[model samples]
Target: MPESTPFHDLAAFIALPRVSSLALSPDGTRLVTAVQELSSDRTRFIGALWEVDPSGERPARRLTRSGRGESAPGFLPDGTLLFLSSRPAADPGEGADDKQEAALWSLPAEGGEASQLLVRAGGIDGYATATAAARIALAAGLLPGAADAEQDERLREARRKAKVSAILHESVPVRYWDHDLGPAVPHVFGVPDAGAEPSVMVDCGARRIGGSGHIAVSPDGSLIAYTAALGTLPDEIRDAVVVVDAATGKQLRVLEAPDAEFGAAAFTPDSRHLVCVRERRITWDSPGDVTLWLADATDDQDPGRDLLPAFEQWPGAPVVSPVPGEDGTPVVWFTADEGGHAPVFRLSTGSGDIVRLTTSGAYSDVVASPDGATLYALRSAVDSPPAPVRLDAAASGQEPVTLPSPGQPAALPGSLTEVHTTAEDGTALRAWLVLPQDARPDTPAPLLLWVHGGPQTSWNAWHWRWSPWVAAAAGYAVLLPDPALSTGYGQHMHERGWAHWGGASYQDVLALTDAALRRDDLDGERTAMMGGSYGGYMANWIATHTDRFKAIVTHASLWNMYSFAQVTDFPAYWMRRQGDPLENTERYERESPHLRAANITTPMLVIHGDKDYRVPIGEGLALWNDLARFEVPAKFLYFPDEGHWITKPNNIRLWYATVLGFLAHHVLGEQWQRPDLV
Candidate 1:
C-alpha cells in the first residue's frame, strides 16, 4: 500500500469519507454502515448508508442516496432495511418538508425504490422492530394536552401563530446536552405494522423525563423496555429500566435499586429473560462498577439475578446472543476496556463464565448471525480507522476476518508504538506514541502531549476530532496518554483520581511524559501540551504547576471548579465528584486550575465553543479574563456555532491551522503567522 499523505492538507483530510456505525441483516449475509462525507460546500457532514458483503467476495456498495442523507439503519425480520431519513418524500401530497425531522423509511428486500413508512406530527426520533412479532415502536415528542396526532398538529400551529417559544418546565433538568427538554415531552408509541398509525405506549408525562429512544423490544414482541428517571431530584435522576406491554403500552414492571442504576435492556433469544446493565452510582470517593443482571420477563415482582457479581472491568451495553448454548442456556456478549484496548467478551448464563474474545482493538455495533455462528462488528485501533470484521461467536482470543469496507480511510502517514510507565503510586500508565516517518535520533521531532477528554475515558480507539497523525505529519511526536481515572484499567485505577482530579492523574500524565521524553527520537526541549475538556482541564493544571512546556493549548476547558460545578449541563454529576461549593470549598480551592492561574508562565491558546453546555463557554471567558488580568501571553479561539466539539469541517481546519501556527511560533521559535480566515 502506498503511504498516505499526512493530514497537513486540511482540505484533503476533511474530504475523506468517514464511517460511523454498522448494522447486520437478520441472516448476517448483508451488512450496512453509515458513512459521513463533507457536504458540497465543505462546511458540514452528510451521512448515507452503504452495504458491505459479509462474504468478503464483493466490494462494498452504496445502498441509499439522498441530499438529506440516511442513518440509523436496522433490518426487519422479512429482510427489508429500515432507516431514518430527512429527505423529502417523492409525493407532493405526502407533506414532506426538507426542514422537517427524520421519518422512518423502508426499502424492500426484493430491491425497489424506498418509500416513507411512518410520519409523526413531531417526527420520529428513533424506532425499533421486533423479529418475531414484526411490531415497531417509535419515540416521538408530544405537545402537552395533545392526545393524538391531529391535536398535536393543532397545538403546534396555535403556538406558531401565537409566536410563543416559551417552555413551561416544572422538572429539575430543563435542558439536556445541547437542546431544551420542554413543552414537547418524549413518548414511545407502538405501530402494529408498516404504514399503521402509532398508538401511545408510554407517556412520559410533563415532569417525567424519558429516554430519547433508548428502547428495545422483546424477541417475541410482547414487551418494550425503556429507560426513565425514577425521581425528579438532581441526585435522584439515575435511570431505571421500565418494561411495558408492547400492545397496550401498560407498565408491567419497574426495575430499580437504591445503590445501582439499570439500562440497556436486551431480551434473550427465548424471550423468557431480559438482561440489563447495572451501574453502581458514583460517590465522592468510590468509582462505580458496571455488571449485568437477568430479569424474568413474565413476572414483574421478581428481582433480577446478578450475573457478574465481582466483575472488575466496567462492561458496555449487554447484547444477548441470538443462538442458545449447547446446554440450552443463553449467552451474553459485551465489550469492555482492558489495558489499552476494548475487547469483546462473552458470558455464559448457565455457568456464569466470562471469556474474552478479541485480543486487541475496540469493537462496537456488534451484530450476531441468525444461527449465532458469527459476529459482525466495526473494529478500530489507535493506528486504524473503523472497519467491518467478522468473528467466530464461540471462540476466544481469535483474530477477526476483515470484510470489504466502503471508502476505507487512507493508510496512516506515520507509525504507532506503545509506551508504558508506572505512576508514582505503582499504578500502570500507558500511551500510544505517534512518531513522524522521518524522525531520527539526530533530528528529533518536537513532542506534543495530547491529553484525552473524558478524563475517565481511555485512548483505546481511533479518534477523528483530536487525531495525532496531523501533529505527526508536521514532524512532531504525539503522546496520547491514558492516565489515572481512565477506564479499562479496573476500579482501583479510577479510585486513584476519584475525587482528587488533579492530584494523582496529573502526576501520572507527567510521569508518562517523562518516560516518553527519555527517548532519543523525541525532543524534550521543544515540547508543548494540548487537550480538550478534561484534557483541557489538565492542560490548565499543567500550566499552573510547571513551566516545563513552552506552550499549551486548552479547548473547552473547565477552569473554575466552583462555577463549572454549578453551570455545567450535569451539575449533579460534577457535584458528585467535587461536592457542593457552599459546603465543600476545600476540594474546589485545592484542585481548581483558575485559582492558580497567576503562577502560569507558559504561552497559552484558549479555545471554546459558545454552544457548548458540557464545559460551557463561561469557562473560556473566565480563563481569558484571568490570563489578561495576570499579564499572561494568550490567544482565544472562539467558535460561535459549534458545540462541545468543533465539528464543522471549515472550522476544524481553521482550528488545526491556528494550533499548528501557535506551536510553531512558541515551541519552534518561528515567526507568528495568523491562520487564513481568522
Candidate 2:
C-alpha cells in the first residue's frame, strides 16, 4: 500500500471528496463537476463546483465556495456557468433568506463572484438549459388553487400560520418513495433569461403529480419535452413523454402506448426529432424490456421509430449528439450494463446500427462535443471512484483518457478480480471478488458475501453507500454479484426471477458464492454475509435456508412479504410483481423470510432508518421482535432521521464502524465491541 494513501483510516475515507455529477461547456472547452465533502462540523456532505480542463492538461481548480455550497452545474450559450444554491443574495434587500430554499445562480466564464439569477417562492427542484436558444427551464412547486407567484406565497404563509401539515389526496399514490405528495403541486416554468422572473409553462395538473420525470428543451428552444403520469391508479400510473410549445405551453403531442412507458427525453440538435427511452411494462409471467425510440417532433400522429429494437441490454438516459451524421441522421449515445461492465455506446438514427465506445467500467452523465467527435463522462468501477474521462464517440472498444480530477480518492489497500460460474439452469453468472492485500493460500482472508440492493440493478458502478473497499480494507474478501434478477444479462435473466424473487435469484447467488469459495485465497469457514434493501431481504432468506455463514447483517430489508407489499412506499409496484397477497397467499407464505424465522441460527445485526418509507420502520421493529422471539443472537441499529440510504457524514461513519465491529466479533472470533459515538 502507498504511504500517502489513507485506505486504512475510516475517518479519512469518510472525509474524502466525493464527485456526483459532471457537465461540459457548450463549446466543450471546459468541464465542471460537483464534488461533495464533509462539512466543517463533519455532520453532512456539502457540494461545490470544480472546473477541469477538457484537454486533460491543467489540474482542476475550485470555482465556487459557500457554507451552503452549490450544485447542478450547467453552461449557458454565453459561457456563463449556472448552478443551484441556497446562499443568501449579496444584497440584504434582495429578500434572501438564510434558511431559504435553493435558487438559481450564475457565474461568469471570465471569473467573478456568482450572483443570484432567479428565485421562486418554492425554490427550484431542477433546471435544464438550452445552448442554441439561450433559454432555461425550471421545475418548481406551486400550491393548489394558486395561479401565480403572489398567490402561491400567500397560500404558504396561511398554511404555516394555521400550523397545518395535512395533505388531501384523490389519487392512489398518496406518497412517493420517502415523502407524502400534495399540498403543493409541481410545475415547469420557462425563465426568459438569467436574472429574470420565470413564467409558468406547464401546470402539470393536480392529478399528474410528481411533476415531470425527466425534462429536456429543444436546441432551437421552441419546444419542451417532459415525462408525466398517465393516470392516478397504481398500475395506471404509467409515464409518458409530453411535448409542448415552449413559449405558449400549449400541448403539442403525447407519445405513449398501453404497454410501454417512456422517459428520459432528449431533443436532436436540429430540433426536428426527439429520442427517449421506451420501457415495456412487466406482467405476471413476462419481464419488461427497455429500448430507444425516435419520435418526429413535427407530427404528433407519428408513433415514432424504434432505434434499437434488437438490443438486449437496458440503456441508461439517452443523449442526442449535437452534430449529425454525414447522411444528415441524428446520432445518439447511451450507457448500458453488459456483463459486469457499464460502457458507452453510439446508435445511428439512420442505420439503426450500434457501436460500442468503451469496454470496461461504468459511464454516466455523458456529454457530447459540438462536433460529436469526442465524448465526456464520469467513469468508475468496483476498484475505483468516479473520475472524469474523455472518449472518442465513434471509436469501438477503446479506453477513455482520464482527465485531471480534483480530490481524487487514495489508492486502495487491495485489488479486484472477476469470478464466474454457471447457474443451475446453465446460465452464466459473474461477480467481482475484492481480495485484501495480505491474503495468501495458507492464510486465507475471511469471506464477506455482500449482496447488492436494487434487486433489479447490477454491480456495475462505484457506490458510496455500500462500498466494498471498506470491507476489503478490514481484511475481508468481498463478493459483489449480479444474480438472476440482475440487469445487463438481457430479458430472460430477469424473467427467471420476475415474481419468484427468492427462487432462482437465491440459487444464483449461492452458485456464484460457491465458485468464489473454491478459490484458494478465500476462507470458506470464517465467512459472513450482508446486504441492504433487497439484498437485506436475501440475507434474511439465506439465514433461514442455510447456516453456512456465522453472521448476517441486514439493513433496511424486507422481512414480511405480505406486510411489505402493502405498506412499502410504492405498494402498488410491489403488488404488481407479487400479486395481491390476500389472493396470492401461497407465494407470500413460501417466499417471505419471516415465515421461516425459527430456522435462522446465524447471529445477525439489523439496521434501519425511521424515515425510510420504502421499507418502513415497522419492518425493522418486527424483524427485531422475531429475532428475540426465536432466541437468535441479534442487535438492532436504528436511525431516527435517515431515509433508505444513510447520507449524513457522521451517520455513514458510524454505519461502517458498526458493521466492521460486528463482522470482527462474529467472523474473527473477537469480543463484541460497540462503535464509539453510537
Cα error, candidate 2, residue 12 (Å):
0.4
Worst 10 residues of 2 by lDDT: 203-212
Question: RMSD of model 2, in Å?
Answer: 1.7
Residues forming the 10-long window of minimal summed lDDT in candidate 1: 204-213
User: What is the model-wide C-alpha lDDT for candidate 1?
Assistant: 0.84
Cα lDDT of model 1 by residue, 88-152, tens digit: 78783534464567889999988889998887766788888787777787877889889877788
Residue 632 lDDT in candidate 2: 95
Give the top-scoring candidate (lDDT): 2
Residue pairs with colliding backbones in model 2 are: none
Tell me the lDDT of model 2 at 159.
89
lDDT of 1 at 604: 97
After best superposition, candidate 2 residue 260: deviation in angstroms? 1.7
